[model samples]
Target chain A: MTTATIIQSLASGLLMGLLYGLVAVGLALIFGLMDVTNFAHGEFLMLAMYMTFFLFAFFAIDPLLAAPLVGAAMFVFGAVAYLLVVRFAMRAKANIGMVQIFTTFGLAILMRGLAQYFFTPDYRSINVSWLGGKTISLGGVFLPVPQLVGALVSLAAFGALYFFIKKTDFGRALEATREDAGAVALVGIDKNKVFALGWGLGGALVGLAGAVMAMFFYIYPDVGASFALIAYVTVALGGFGSVFGAFAGGIIVGLVEASTALILPPSLKSVGIYAVYLLVVFIRPRGLFGSI
Target chain B: MDDAHSKRRLRDLIVAAVLTCIAALVPLFVKDVYVQNIMVLTLMYAALSQAWNILGGYCGQISLGHALYFGLGAYTTVLLFTKFGVLPWFGMLGGGLISAVIAMALGYPTFRLRGHYFVIATIVIAEIGFLLFHNWDWAGAALGIDIPVRGDSWAKFQFTRSKLPYYYFALVFCCVAWLVTWWLENSKWGYWWRAVKDNPEAAESLGVVVFNSKMGAAAVSAFLTAIGGAFYAMFVSYIDPESVMTFQFSLLMALPAVLGGIGTLWGPVLGAVILIPLTELTRSFIGGSGRGVDLILYGTVIVVISLARPEGLIGLFAKRRKEVAR
Candidate 1:
């Protein structure tokens, strides 16, 4: 293989990795704060993608401009979801983990059903978006314009997220709540509020990813199913609960996926990622940036 | 055994016997092929769920990637028979053994990880298998293996003329699964499993009992699940990665146990009884539109049931029994 070819794939892999990180960070944040794995997270992405598609179709808003609007809408959706469904799941006295898994899973199925009922199971995409069908040359390597923009937006979001979590009062509150849910009540902090906000933040992050993905990817009911597995693998790979871990995990996953694509058939590329996940977990158990 | 436990066991056995007798007579009264199909499905699912309950319910290992084992069973039977002309009776046993070994092999790395990590690992492993099978040209790749119908004989385990044989086989499979669970419930391994499920750390302090019990459960759970897969392959007469080894099959097996009762012997059967027919009816009636109304109903039922009764529907029965005793 030529070095340029390797670098070309790696370059695109880096951009895709950033987006993957953004897709995964919300899930990581949710798990980090509360030990719940939202199995419906992929469905959330699907909804956001559809939201982008509709916004563009109806109002002609470019995906780039519609990103924040989609994120804000998803924030409300996420918070309400937590309040309506996940809150009850958390209160379960028995089989707490399974309850969470299945409930979110059911929610995923419901969302898919609803999406299919509404969207008619057709694959839709933003054909005329501002960044759609464009490419840029970076250091003699080509990358899609949408993906480049997505990588930049993702980096900015991560920076803002870091600042928000480390510097902001709400972030510290989120941290405190996760550290000790019982103790936070002693300090007059409402546990539910933090969790709700956390869910919102997580949702918004993935919402941003969905919008970016919609520019280049198809919008459909089951679109989230495949990416959902990858997101879970990313979150778990990055050590389950660490937000930074998810970021790191996404890059690793993207590069692994890209490299695998180079070596194996396109269909077998995901096998490389799955294989790597098994290998990593077998050795490290917690993941790369996960707390030991 | 304690009088109450033994008495409860005896009552369970009697109830099972009566139920089996009733179920055996079902084929006589129900002649419609569609209803017969549903019954076969219900029994097969009950057996599959019961097997899942052993590891997932009793041992408390929530594996969402059981499709790998199911696929393995289906593939093993189909491959051995189609390629080598081996009888399915032998293929079923071979599939069971392969699944049991694979379960242990997988459990080795995965069992040490706790909660979601373990769950995701199982999912990833199964997905990898699915991908491989999809690309495996020798095994018919994505198109999958079509078992050529030979003569209608018990040896081949294929009967085109009658659904009766499949129905009976499924019924016996269901009974054996129930009986196995019942027998294991009182065994030493059962005690260890319950203990390990309740508190793995404390159980682990007893020197490998936790690990050992989990391994045991996974093997048995996997073996029976594989047997179900083999039956399904023969019954359907077609095997594909999408049909057998996808993530959906794993979820299907776990659902009956989860809804009816995860750890209980009767949970899978009861859950399958109510669920399989509802699923079939919904799919046939409303799902014909391909609009996914059935999915909406299914998702709603699962969420409501899991949220409302985390211990499963079996708890309601147990609660009523307790009240009556009082």
Candidate 2:
């Protein structure tokens, strides 16, 4: 109601928006690389959270420490998924687009089932990670420490991603492959290998987001379902296949979500996000930064 | 080729009629309530999926948000029947009209978005509807509606004693949807839709009203899907936001068409028949443990089928038939 409260909420919203960007950027990255939407990108997050949880639960490692481990593990997972599933999906001679959507969707379901089978579908959360239950006040606005750290981590990841895409040899190869997969092959790059690595890179990005999310969010089998839509919205709102657009989209979505919560009931908060998404796409069609 | 095509159309009609006759007699021979229940579900899904095929398959506008119309149909019927004492039959028509109008209205802006943008718009719109219904108190909010038992009569559309009538209604519904698809397949609109699907630019150049074709597909698809939702409300005799309108409902409606063969005439029916029973059996047998075995099997089948036979199992039959003729 007051400007002070508004400022505080907006601050928290900005942080959450950064994490949303992190969650969505991988989807944007993969879509940019190849026109396939994972549809299970959220499940990949769920998996990473579980990985972080297990590492914390058994090995006594903190989630902060577990982030890199989860990222590394998820890289392999993402690459293997591409090789085993997406590779076949890409080759589908008919209804290739639907095939891609459904295959990744199927994988998401299978992962959820497996999670339920092994993890018992019980909601688990790390109660005592160093930053889990802590909060900090900055200029009369209080922010959850986990989300703050998550925002910081997201910025760091984006920075690294910028450099990775703009500076590194692999990043250049990735850019080259994304521009024209067939032509990349003529230039002696293994197209499949590049794609698999792209998938891995995308996977690792979401993995980082998942680790931070595990600090505060409940870890469960179906947890991915809720956020997956938002991730999709963020990706599309920024314009599909543009990673920076995803980041911008995530910030816009988060701010809108926060402002909507201020006006509407919390339950109806998503209406604001969906409305903004529709409004944006309606006006621009391709999204804010989408290619013509 | 034209003669053969006409001959095939006649044979298709005959085959459909014969299949309907055979299906009607199925409950008479098999008296298990559980089996009958699954049969009812299969038929309902067949009808729903058929409606979805009109837009998603035939028109190549893949919508994963049919649940909005389904939930709307259900809500309209239950609200009208419970509050004003209107019969569900009239309610079904009313719901269908509302959904069709809404589809066209939403389609006005959304149809411009190509590919994922359009698909996600449908999802977001449906989600907005779901959230509103979830929070709307007068409409029973998230708890949903429970249809009171007025009587066991065809006029009332409620039969507690036996599901036979419901089964027959579902059968007719399925047949009508299939027949509609069959009819539209050869119509000017149908050809226009296919042309739009294959290549909208080319179709546009060929004088097809691409946007209108998509709008038409949306209206019809939403209308039919709404009818299915109304029937589902009556059949379940209870309606809730979660049950009728969710992301899962949209996916479930689309699954049969996808599994059987998208855009094909028999795809929805064939997919529903094969998938509905398998899901029911799996849920009862292995899913009872809460370990998600049913989901595992279901997911595996989806992945394998999409990979192995993206065209659908109907393609297998078509291939075999061609081989036999050869």
Candidate 3:
């Protein structure tokens, strides 16, 4: 392959990887804080995409502009979900793991069912004149405007989250709770509040991802299912609870997916990603950057 | 106390025998093709769910990618029959053996990962299978494969006029699955599985050979599921990656077990009996326009059951029975 083609693929993969990382980071954070794997996480992304779609369809709001609102709305939805469903499962006396797991699984189905009932399963896309039909050339590589915006926005969100986690008291408390809920409680931190906040933050991040993606991708109820699997793989490959690991793993997965197209059929791109996932799971279950 | 226990056991056996006879004779009395079809599907799901229970319930390894085995069984049996003119009965056994081997290979490395990691790995494995089959032209790729229709024949495992033969076939499979589950529940391996599930470290300390036990359970589970898949292929007379290897298929297999009672002997059967009819009826009545109401109902039932009764409907019955005994 020529250098230009390689560079172009790498560049596009990197951009896509950032968004993948953003989606996975939410899942990783939630898992880290609450020890609950939200199987409905992709549905959250689906909901956000629909939210963005509605905003664009009826109100003429650009997806970029709708991102924050959608994120905030999803944050509330996530918090409420945790309070109603997850909390109950957490409090169950027996079979805690099975109960919690199926709760989220059920929620995923419910969300998908609701979406199908309302949206009728048709693929919908936002028609943004500026984001659509535009590309920028950087040296030897061409970058699509929507993808560039998605990558930039995701990077900024990641940066903001890193700052919040490292520099803020709330973030420290969240980390503390993840380590030892009782210890955090001894220090006057409400463990439930921290857990709820973690869920909300996770939801908001994926919400932002969905909003940005809606600009360039199709919006459908089941669209989140495949991406959700990819995000889960990214989380596991990144070492479960580590945000930085998720980011790195996402990029690696993206690069692997893109580069494999050079030799493999496009339909089999996921095979390459899954093969890497299996290898990582067997060889280094802790992931590349995970301290845990 | 021994006499009471023996009496209860005899009564349970008699009840089971009677129920089996009734099920076997069902196709004769209820001649509606559609109802028979539903019964066949119910039996198929019961067998699949029981197969899942062997690993997910007994071994405490919630594999969300069971469709891998199911798909493998379907594809292998269909391919053997279509390509080599092998009879489906033999082809079904071949499919089960293939699934068992694959399960062992996968379970060896994956048993080390706990909980969600295992679940995720299973999903990835199934997706890989799905993608590979979807793209491979030899497997018919995205277009899928259709088995040529033939007149009713026991050798081909095909029925043209009546669904009776298929019903009996499904009933027999379902019975065998239940019997296997019953045998496992009474075996030493059953105790080993329960121990590992309750506390792996403790079980290991006591020399439970956790890896081998889990692998065995997975192999058995996959074998049974594959047989179900093979039957499904013949029953449907077509096979595709989307139908057999998707995550949705895995979910459907697990749903009956989860809804009825994971790890329990009759849970899968009860779950299948209840859920299949509910979905089928909903689909016939309002499915065309409503599209997803049944799914919504399923989601609601699952959520409520998980939170309120994780042991499922059987658990509730057991509780009431205990109360009555007291």
Candidate 4:
């Protein structure tokens, strides 16, 4: 292969990988703190995409400009979801796995159904004057402007999140709760509030990723279904609850996906990804960075 | 006490006899082709879900990848019949054995993972299966395979113009699956499985070979589910990876057992009876314009039941009976 071609593929893969990492961090955080997988996590991403679309369609605002608004809306949605569905499932004395699984699975179907009802299952995309149909030439390779911006936004979001978790007292409390909820409670921290905040932050992160993606990707009711499995694989490969691990895992998965496409048939590219996932699961269940 | 026990046994026998007779006779009375079709579908789901219950409910290992086995069984039988002219009867048995072996192979490595990790593994494995089949030309790839239409022949397991034979075939399979579950519920394996499910570490401490017991359950479950898959291949006379190996198919197989009562012997049957008809009626009444209403209803039901009554409908009945006795 030519060096230029290889550079181009790697550049695109790196950009895509950043967004994938953003998609998985929310799932990892929620799982680490709440101990629920949130099967409907992808649907939340779908919601954000739709939210971005509506904001653009109704007010003629650019999706990038409205990303924070969508993120804030999703934060409230996530907190409320935790209070209503997840808390009750956690409280159940028997069959905790069954209850938790179906609750989120049900929510996923519910959200998809509601989206279809409202949006009619048609694929939607945002077309901004600045973002659409533009590319930047980097050395000898070309990079799509929308994708580049999305990747930068994801990196910024990741950096901000890392700073918050590492530097802030609330972030420390969140981490403590994840490590040992009973111990955190003994130290006068409210475990419930910490969990709710985790959900909110997780939701906001995914929502921002969704808005960024909406600038370039197709938007639909079932759009989340495609990304949901990939995000789950990222979370597991990253070691369940570790945000940095999820980010690293995402890049690894993206690289594997893009590089394999050069060798395997398009249909079999996913097979390669799944094979990697199975290997990681069998060989290292704790993931690359997970402690337990 | 002896007299009461005998009387209860006699009553159970009578109930079983009556149900069997009704199952045999109902298709004859239902003249509508649509109703018979629904019955066939309901019975197929009943068998498939019962097979799932063996692993997911009794053993407490939730596999969202059961479609892998189901598709394996279907493809095995279809390929053998189309290539070598093997009778579907023997092909069905071959399919089941293949599925059982595959399940055992997957189960050994996966059963080590607990809870959600196990669940994720199942999904990934199933996706792998889908990808492989979607690209494999011998299995017909994405275009799928169609069994050549043959006139009504018991040897080929193809029926022309009569839904009755297919209905009876499905009913028999469903009954067999139910009987196996009933037998397992009373057997030593059943006790071992319950122990493992309730607390694996404790069960191991008490001399149970936890891995072996789980593998045994997985084999039996895969075997029965494969038979249902083979039957489905003949019933539909068409097979595709998208239809048979998708995550949606896996979830649908598990839904009935969850809805009726996961661990109960007759939960799958009860759940199939309720769900299949509900799906059909919604499809007819709401039609195409109301595409997602049925799914919305199903999601609502599942969420409400999981939240308010994790034990399901049968569990509610059992609870009432205990209260009355007290």
Better of 1 and 4 by DockQ: 1
What are the root-mean-square deviations of the candidates from the true structure over C-alphas? 1.0, 0.8, 1.7, 2.2
DockQ of 3: 0.69
- Residues B1-326, model 1: lDDT tens digits: 88998999999999999999999998999999999999999999999999999999889999999999899999999999999999999999999999999999889889988888888999999999999999999999999999999979999999999899999999999999999999999999898999898899888887647877899999999999999999999999999999999999999999999999899989999999989999999999999999989889888998999999998999999999999999
How well does candidate 1 match the true structure in TM-score terms?
Answer: 0.99
Candidate ordering by TM-score (highest first): 2, 1, 3, 4
- Cα lDDT tens digits, model 3, B1-326, are 37885676567667778999999877778888899899999999999999999999888999999999999999999999888889998889999999999999998899998767789899999988888899889989998899997677998999878788888888889889988887787689999999999999999999999999998999899999999999999999999998889888898899888878888887888889998888788778766676577678878888998899877778888898899999
- Name every residue pair that clashes in candidate 2: none
Docking class of 1: high
Candidate 2: docking tier: high
Candidate 3 Cα misplacement greater than 4 A, ranges? B1-12
TM-score, candidate 4, first chain: 0.97
Of 1 and 3, the candidate ahead on TM-score is 1
- Over A60-149, each residue of candidate 3 has an lDDT whose tens digit, in order, gives 988889999999998998898898888898987767887888899889988988999989889999876458768999995899989999
Q: Which pairs clash in the backbone of model 3? A: none
**What is the DockQ score, from 0 to 1, of model 1?**
0.82
The local lDDT score (0 to 100) that residue A76 gets in candidate 4 is: 94
TM-score, candidate number 3: 0.97
Give the better candidate number (1 or 3) by DockQ: 1
Which candidate number has the best lDDT? 2
